[model samples]
Each structure stands twice: as C-alpha cells, then as structure tokens.
Target: MLGSAILERRLELEVSQEKLAEMASVHRNYVGKVERGEQNLTIETLVRFAVTFKCKPSELLAEAGL
Candidate 1:
C-alpha cells in the first residue's frame, strides 16, 4: 500500500503515530492503517485528523488524495 501524505507530514514534524492518535482521539492502529492506505475514513475521522494538524479537511484531503 502507498503511504499517506498524512504519514509524510507527521514524520516531517517528528510526531509519533500514537501521539497523533491521542491528539485526534482515534485509535493508534487506525492511524497506522490510514497511513498505510488501508482505512476508508469517515468525514468525522478526517476532521479529527485535520484538527489535530490544524489544517482544513479539504487541504488534508488534497494531500491524502481522497
């Protein structure tokens, strides 16, 4: 599976998957699956992630190619 730009950005900022999950209120494994392009994300979940990154959901979608 292709790695997500979310993963790229997270790594760029030196944030751990667990930490991101904590901040996003998501399961860590869900973040891992998302990073690995294995998750079919809901809008709410995407919003949680976008909020964690302090970015717009559309921007995150563009980055993630959703």
Candidate 2:
C-alpha cells in the first residue's frame, strides 16, 4: 500500500513525520493521514513525497504495488 511504502521510506530516511511533511510541502496532519492510509494522494503530492525521499515516483508507486 502507498501508506506503508511512504511510512517505510520515511523511516528508512530517519526522518520524523513533521520533517517529511515539511520536506514534501504538505501539512503534518496530511502526512499522518497519508501514512495511516486515510487519504488519497494527488500525483503532484506523490511527486513531492518522491522528491523528498530522493526516489522516483514510479518507484514509490511500485512499492505500493500500483
């Protein structure tokens, strides 16, 4: 799932949810919801997260099995 993948990558990077949110230019609550599978993400947001994590968006999607 996207949430799991995002959470895993964030942890792998040793960053806090708040830091990830800042890096991705998203709200902290949004990041939390995202990691909890409580939100649907737009492509722009996905790209932001990928950029923050230094990974390709396709890789993130692949991680999510999408």
Query: For each candidate, what TM-score against the reference?
Result: 0.86, 0.96
RMSD of 1: 2.0
Clash number by candidate, in order: 0, 0
lDDT of 2 by residue, 1-66 (tens): 899999999999999999999989999789899989999999999999999989999999999999
Estimate the overall C-alpha local distance difference test score of candidate 2. 0.94
Model 1 lDDT-worst window of ten: 1-10
Question: Residue by residue across 1-66, what tens digits does model 1's lDDT show?
Answer: 223778876887688999988988988788899988888888898888878888898888787565
Best by lDDT: 2
Backbone collision tally, model 1: 0
The C-alpha stretches of model 2 lying farther than 4 A from their native spots are none
